[model samples]
Target: MTRSHRYRSLLLAVSIAVPAALGTAQAADTVKLGLVAELSGAGAPAGTNWRDGAKLAVAEVNAAGGILGKKVEMPEYDTQTDPQVSRALVQKAIDEGVIAIIGTVYSGSTMVNMLVAKQNSIPQFVGSEAPAIVEKGNPFVYRTSSGAQKGVPALTPYFKDTLKAKKVGVAWVNNEFGKGGRNVFIAEMKKAGIDVVVDAASEQAQTDYAADVAKIKSANPDAVFVYMNQEESARFLIEAKKQALPMPLVGEVTLTEAKVIELAGNAADGAIAHVGVTATATEVPGIAAFAKSFEDTFKRKPTHDAIKGYVGVWATKYVTDKVGKVDGEAFAKTMHGLCLKAADHPKILLDTCWDDRGEMSRPSFMVQVKGGSPVVIGTVPAN
Candidate 1:
């Protein structure tokens, strides 16, 4: 080949290959987000929901031209609902250089990952609402949603004043998630002058609550705080109906998820709990259009997970914008300092963005299962 022609070909290769390689090293569009959750086994349902929520947000960001022209990378890991597995998964993500992680869903799993993140100085955005998530003030961790201690307090007073239940009973899975809640609800109820008639624990993943239900029924509680997952929770409610045990039922935010209605059907009726922001697309600004797209794609309605995911994407946009460029530590620190207000939804444009102790400042609300669906009852303050 002629020297001139060969030189031209080599120049073209250099121009194309070098940029491509650098692009690999550099974060693009927004930033790379890593997630650790129980993507399989019993925890898969919640993990899948969490994954979908983040994806909903990512799609919107990409459509709007991404965060600082860098798109979000939502690569995730399956911790299989085991804390040790979650730790290993997060450590792996850190090695691969993910700037932040969205979830390690189960509280037990999150505790494991939280330690790993603290040790490595990696920022982990946990999906946990358990109070223990923030008690340590670990600089490297951020959690979305309120702590059980913070989130559940407002509801207790209501139960005594509004529901007028004299004796309260509590049942939960014997894990960090359940225990975190049992501790707060019991303390708050006692301080509220409500009698604690029943306190019980079940296996973390137990399917049957018949025996537990009978035991709880024996306590004669005027109301009961059920702190199990969606399926078990639904079963408890259904069994309550079957046994003709009559009382008002209350629970934490987990009770507001769509799964409760789907799993329990009419049995879920009359159940009451607090709701984090539930911004549907129409009421939200940029999100309305995005939610429309998700509904068309998924057929089923977009849920809390989808909204959480979208918020992560939107928050990343703010963080990346300030960073001026993408570096792991830089983006992470920016995220920690980020304060956002995204509520395009005209009716319920809930504001849920902040950097307070590395978590969002959500306006918590109360919802009741009126017709097998949650209906807003009251709003709670951030403090």
Candidate 2:
């Protein structure tokens, strides 16, 4: 080729290479987001699932050119499902300059981190569904998952109308999450004219639940509403089964976790539960595709923990990008009035919105374990 032809070719190559290099440079610049999860202890299943979901959201946002023209980076800390450990991690996260925070599967841990975030003026998304977390008047703390007050509305109706259960029993872990769920469930049951025969509470991270199970067995209610994390709940269910306590079992969202079913086996079959998001409930915009992507990426089906975690990241991003800044004050303002629609992502189970209390208003799906998987039975409206 002639000199002029070679010069033209070289110019085209430079033009292409320069833009690619610029894009790579832009992608390297990042804004840090802190993530706290229970990597060990009873809450590991939920923590691991949440971690995968958040990572997927971050990857997708970065691939699409990131938020505010800066690649988002998540620096994670393990809480070991302990409130004290989570408290320390929250301070560390703020000190390390993460713009926002996410997670802590247990309500007790989330409460600790939420207070820290509030004190530090850092925006945090509490992964637990305890009503008390948001009711604490923390402006910096927001929730993507609905708490017991919101989820139990559907649960009580299912017990009263669908199952036609009159007498009921309640057993819960004695924590903020359990208390919130227990209180709301009892109130709703009363309104629906269902009698709560027995109510019991146990310490968190409980292993042997023979005594507790015995109380529930003695109550002999037509249906039971249990409030505990997956691991402990599995143990409780196993013990209940061994004692031949055969009544219709019902529980909170954690009961639908794969780990619970795996541990409880046939004991979990025919169990009813209320969950915000499930692989079997496809109400979100791109749920089918998201599930396929999640399975392809993690080699497991996404659970309520994963779905909520993914939504939390996107919800944070929505506010961050909307305000064109990732500051705590701006986020607090934008997130309060923000209402996201289902068209945003198919994996999102409900249209996202928040009330003045910083609690989410999202629908819950009533599901039953059938053939070793949760099957959607009904959709509960968000009150």
Candidate 3:
């Protein structure tokens, strides 16, 4: 080969090799995200929903060419619904250089892990709606689901005006989630001028609510507000129906889950609950397509937990992209006042990105179980 020709060939090779090396280096700089879930224990169903939902969103993000020139890497751990386990997992994620954390289906676990996130200043996006999660003054924490403070106000009016309920009986599990929810419900119901004649608090995960149901029946409430997990809630409903309590049953978001209906069977019929979204609501923005896509991917309809997680990932991506960096502080600064358009739908579920307190401000919906499915009653205004 001539000297000049050899020189040109070497230059071309150098140019190709430089870009190739840079590409490899860029690929190696992956953005790690931590997903803390309840992959075992009683919370597994909802936790798995959250995990799968976030995974689907991550898949979509990567398929669309990733973010900041690197693929997002989700390092996940199952907390088994244990707060201590969740706390350790949070530290592990932070130590492993994760920029942000998502999930922990149960409120208790989220609260525990979020404290660690606060100490480390790593942003935590939780799926729980307990009022206390955002009340801890942790700037690093944010939520996709509306909490009791937001849900109760919306629920109280529906009980009074929509359902025409006068005297309501209250049943809740005695835990952070149930107590916080009960306190808010009582305060709101009083404001609505509705009487809560029977206030019954049950032990967490108690199987037999026969005694509690009897007291509620003795009060003969026009409607009953129940705040419990799906298993206990279903057990209570089945027993309540067997005794023919006969009043309309109303509850928080958990009551709207398909699992509740499936567990409660015919007992779930005529029950009312507050829900953020319904996959069956075709009028909802992007719900039809989101449902279709989700069913195709998972071969089943997505739950409220799934949708919350999906939105959480997308919301995180929105802020990260807007800031041009995967940073917790930067995202937190702009998290409030930024309106998020959901990737799958235009239903405007998250009307306000987040309030000053880091609580998600979104419209609420009341759904009723008719033929064992959640049918939308109407929208509940935040104010």
Estimate, for each residue in 268-344, the C-alpha lDDT of model 3 and write its tens digit. 88888888666766676566766777789998778888877777776767678788987777878887566665543
Regions of model 1 farther than 4 Å from truth: 1-30, 279-293, 327-338, 343-349, 353-356
Tell me how far the alpha carbon of residue 5 in candidate 2 is from the true structure, in angstroms, after superposition.
52
Scored by CA lDDT, what does every candidate get?
Answer: 0.72, 0.82, 0.81
> How would you encode candidate 1's per-residue C-alpha lDDT over 270-365 as one tens digit per residue?
888775654332433654665566678677665555565555545655566667765546756665655555534221235555454665666777
- The alpha-carbon lDDT assigned to residue 164 of candidate 3 equals 97
Which stretch of 10 consecutive residues in model 1 shows the poorest summed lDDT? 341-350
Residue 103 accuracy (lDDT) in model 1: 83
TM accuracy, model 2: 0.89
lDDT of 2 by residue, 251-271 (tens): 979886777888889878777
Question: What would you estimate as the lDDT of candidate 2?
Answer: 0.82
Clashes of each: 18, 5, 1
Error of 1 at 121 (Å): 3.3
Model 2: residues with Cα > 4 Å off, grouped in runs:
1-28, 283-285, 344-349
